[model samples]
Target: MFNISLRHSALPIALFVFTLMALTKMRPPNLWAHTQFLLSYDVGTVRRSLIGQGLAWVFESGLMQSTIFALAAVLTLSGAAAMVLFMARALARLDGGAEVLLVFVTSVGMVTFLCNTGYLEGALALVGVAALILPVRGALPLIAKCVLCIVGVLIHDIMLPTFALLVGLQLFLSRDELPVASRIALGALPVALTAAVLTALFLLSPDAAESYDTVFATVTDRALDFPTRKGAVEAVMSYGPGMEPAYDSVWGSDLYRFELIYISWIGVAITLWLLVAAARLISHRPMLDRLALVAAGLGPLSLLLVAFDVSRLLGVAILHAFLVIAVVLLIDESARVKLRSVFTQQAIVLLLIVNVVVGFRPLNGYPEFGDDFPGAVMELPLWWNMPPSGGRLTQNPGE
Candidate 1:
């Protein structure tokens, strides 16, 4: 038996989600046409707090943001499982800490590859991380950091501010060899990147926002808000992507919703705990020793950071990952058996808890037949054994 503790791990977080979807139905469907029309247009202003607001105007709904809010919530849940890949790699490096940097490189690379099927915050956050860690080597590291920063910016322009700050760190404080003029020249890159981020956010956010509002409007129009229909709303939201899936073998038909407050608070609490732990280890241990502890700690922070806001989270997760790599080095490469042993246990227990808590319920819904064929477990980094399919989504003609 997996045990109650195991069941309550991250897995219950899914229940939290189901509960949220069930409890709050933002608005009705026909009134959603305006929002949906905007979604079809991919307009930017609508996403900038306008669409959600506008929809509320038509519906008198309160405080509910946009569809992105729901989507972000769903992704936030997915993000927890995503970090398992990073933690697994970090643990595997228990014997070789210095090279833990490479493990990070591999972990981020692999996670990003699997992330959102190739376009997720994990990819962007990982890029930001590479920005900070790659620079320990000065010039070589500087170049690497710049490349990563640029890459992160490209992945999600919102990440520019974070990377831009890092660019400042790498050029001014970290890279001793870079001359003044060269540093100045390099400094301009972040400025340019910042501009790019602003432009993109201004231009694209509206469309995303509008599309989401439309979805919310649609949900509302259907009066899916009723406690009775909550299950159906979650069904459409969780599994209804652009091109529905082929099976509903995950959580059966009774999908649940999450409460954002609970999700964020819990994530924040866990983040703070790890932060405190890592801080203690960093203060006590040697440079290498610190790396191990930090790596173990980074998993939660990265997840929390992204969970809050992609932009801020991207910057922080990047910085944390860099530090996590250093800590990994300290723990895995430590000459002291006692120290390494302590870290090994801490790392294992921490991650195991995380995995158990991030419930891996299958998303139950199909695009075509609505049959209950099992879906694949969310395999991070593409190598872990398959997770049991969690639930199902029956095909609906509504789309």
Candidate 2:
């Protein structure tokens, strides 16, 4: 039984259990404005591309149009399956206790934030991450990697930054295997590729840019719109003074506080983990390890560009955290052992129990309004905290 469990049931059993919990936590597609945007796609606007149009078509189907929960569950399960298969394959390629820890950490990370988030873009982000983490062996694999990068970007342009970060990490990790000049050239590839694709896409469909521009304007305008009567915006936007007002807003003060506490905790944890990983990499001082150290150090800088939005910042942070952990494990075997010791089997059991308990809440997003699954769940305890959603579909205070 022990051998059988270790060889077969360990990862699959855990993943299956988490998938069921995540399904219950899945929020209906219409709750958020971005999902709504995808749901309302039309030929007249450039707001959506292939993915959006596909989702809109699916949702428009007779029963699907009204059965919002079914749509959410399908997306969550499909994306979760894709991510689990990719990560399992990646972990299986390696051997030893390191494999055990990587499986645990990556699985927890995905269930907590990356996978089964019930958002189309979040699902695509996992696909992008899996494509990046997959081992490259030959020219064919490299070509596939590039294609996956393109697909991820086409799904959602925000992934462009993530693609660039992965490019930098890849170049660093493979530096010793290639020449100096080749490394320099590879460093520029992500930017050049992104530019070339954007230019081509614009030439093919200029209206996409127009649609995104309109969306950006709408997003910014809504953020700036505040309930001046109670100073809700000023309070939430402030990092220190007078935060209580927004925290007490009918829009859901508890949610705002939860987001602040959760994000801050994530930020601190990743920062500390990076430092510890860097120390290990510095000690051995292998070329590849050193390169990974530098990449980890520079990775957080990308968040500066998207700092205005909290969700985007957290999303980037989560991706960076995953990248840092993966690279450190590749270079330093000891780090994996350290992770296994700290995380512990009992701790994992507790986490799984917590996830199961939360699954009963029906407290998915928009709890300020009411629970869509009132008897089943109660709060948005998931890691992916979205920024205030608004657009043509939902009302922002000013709109």
Candidate 3:
């Protein structure tokens, strides 16, 4: 009874069970363990997802993107800290009851990204949130935030679509709620910003876009598939000239498999969270609960809908939001603490611990590299073309 009872055998057994439990519950690793991958390539979402994955690669290898991403991350972290302090100050000046939730939403998007990714996409997103919540009662605040967001567009084009999405989402959801003049005013800034960017990109040219991507990719090492990336992109894009979809799906098989795993989990968590939220809202429409859901979902669903290529981003965004929402929903509002339900609470804590462990691997194994090594990763994408991974992909990706 006092003996350890053959602990070595139990170690592998324990790890096996733990690994199985995590994989069964989630496919992605680290901070976004609960997330699912996406399928659609809605332009905006694609750019951001690419920014994340591409940046991770560059940072990991200490290759093409290391310097730029390192610099960008530092810059983003600094900028976010400053902005949050500013946002908090700005919030203090406001009087709306929803303003506190607005600040929390801003913090979740800005602060969390600063902690996790710190890519240019996240940085640009931070600026846009600053613009959105800068409290524009008069023209000065509005003009300032809009201008800041516009300026940020050059840093990452992903922000453009996000701006459009936010404006559109607000317009669609609040159309009946807002007066006509308020609607027009709300539409003007984002519409103008989108038009200007589209015109600029249109005028920029294939050669220019290619050149810019190359330079940016070189600088950040986060370029989507560098045209010359010999392994995957080249093998596919280089296929005998006549190809149906310009992308190289042939070389992309491995990438696609990982993509499938990530997207499937995102679907599971999002639908689960939304249904749960809907059910709670239907039963008891508390202002606080509604605020929690709104804040929790805002950035993620926005990114998912606007994503351009990879479904992985949806998986990335959804579970992150779902976990936070689930926590907020179940927590005891009156006690100054709460719980969504027993299941969700356990899931959230377990997920938090796992993600922390996952996050550290990229740092330890890779060291100079930004992401985890082979064994460190639980991501199916990382193990694509392998036995179990390939088998996992057999059933039409997410199905």
Candidate 4:
């Protein structure tokens, strides 16, 4: 179970406050679109689908903007806390107290992505991270993990298939710990429950038929929104060829693409690095560990199939897979394979590189370029700048 002792409470509290202030200062203009559309229940908005509006609706409608941001900070800390505790427990189980530094390094990587610019993603990604590390030996934890995995899909459908497979793999591998009956039921439970939830939310609504009609129209409209060049073969083409410039006027295209592409490459590199490490570490491990390595290792392939924002997808997948790798490393550490030796001077170099790349966002003259250095330090290098707050149109459509 996750206990909040006095000693550990301070860290989460501090993280919450720090993240709250940072996210507050880091708030971009475009954020309003996501919140406003979700809060208004505007099912016709095609850009951000309603798949993952469960948590967004809660935060946006249940609280004032200022209060809701604080809630976001709390959720961010909660995800960070999960990472720290999970890593710590994994290390302790391995009797690798000497390699606490490795735990710290891993925790920092998780935080870098989990606490990234988007407040909503912080919660969604945290739920994803928790699924990766939650204790599954017991029935309760396993069920909870399934529920979270389902909820994660509902929160953002872009990575649904990838993460759903991940949840399934975990359930299938827990056969040794769980009875055959339990394993079979758990495997089927998540998808069943998810279907139930979706039915209740969208299908059972007052305008059930109209809801589906609106959803179809919205999806079709969004698909047509991005037309290819005259002779292009695919619907989605790379930026700069045929697509018109759609960057917000405030960003002015000065540093967006270069920085974005830079981070995308970084995301790919980190994803490969973590998976390669897991492959090596889990070579002789139990079936569960080996299967998890495969699932986490291949989860990033979603990038190729889905054209959602590359920066967020890659970054989130990298961190999510990194957490799985860290878990495998700790679980499979042999008497011969020591943490100290696993991460030597090379680990220091890796940590430094991650901090530099993940720490800095592209220069967008945010908070007035040189004006808010403190915000820059806490929330600099936002993956993308949103339109200003309060500038969003917020008329409720589905009310």
Query: Which candidate number would show the highest lDDT if scored against the true structure?
Result: 4
Which is better, 1 or 3, measured by TM-score?
3
Off-target runs (Cα >4 Å) in candidate 2 are 1-9, 33-48, 55-71, 89-116, 133-135, 195-262, 271-275, 278-316, 327-363, 366-399
Q: Which candidate number has the best TM-score?
A: 2
Give the poorly placed runs of model 1, Cα more than 4 Å off.
1-119, 125-135, 140-144, 158-257, 284-347, 360-399
* Candidate 4: C-alpha lDDT: 0.45
- Model 1 global lDDT (CA atoms, 0 to 1): 0.36
Q: Write the per-residue lDDT of candidate 2 for residues 1-399, one digit (tens) a residue.
A: 122124344466646655665654455433332333342224333322545456556644322323444555665566555544544543442333333433433432443343223445454555566566655445665666666666665655545565545654565555547776676566446545755665554444423223434433432333222211222112112133432333234334443343344343544454455445445534544564565455544454455443333333443454455455555555345554455444345544554343233211111343322222211222233234543322111222211
| Tens-place lDDT digits, model 3, residues 82-126 | 433433332222222122223232221322243333334445545
Candidate 4 has its poorest 10 consecutive residues by lDDT at: 228-237
User: What is the full ranking by lDDT, best candidate first?
Assistant: 4, 2, 3, 1
**1-399: candidate 4 lDDT, tens digit per residue:** 332222334345434543543444333213322232232244532222343244345543333435444555565556555555555555453333324324343332443444343334555556766675666567788778778866664554433544454555555544546675666566556655655554444433323223444443332332222221111111111233343323223133423343244445656666676666556655655664565556545665565443423444564565556555455554454622654444444553565456434532311113232222222333333334753222221221101
What RMSD does model 4 have? 10.8
**Weakest ten-residue segment in model 3 by summed lDDT:** 31-40
**Tens digit of lDDT per residue, candidate 1, span 283-322?**
5444433442343344434443323222123223433544
Number of backbone-clashing residue pairs for each candidate, in the order shown: 52, 10, 31, 8
Quickly count the clashes in candidate 1. 52
What's the residue-level lDDT of 213 in candidate 2? Answer: 42
How would you order the candidates by TM-score, starting with the best? Answer: 2, 4, 3, 1
C-alpha local distance difference test of each model: 0.36, 0.44, 0.36, 0.45
User: For model 2, which pairs clash?
Assistant: 247-253, 360-376, 361-377, 361-378, 362-376, 362-377, 362-378, 363-377, 363-378, 363-379
What TM-score number comes out for model 4?
0.57
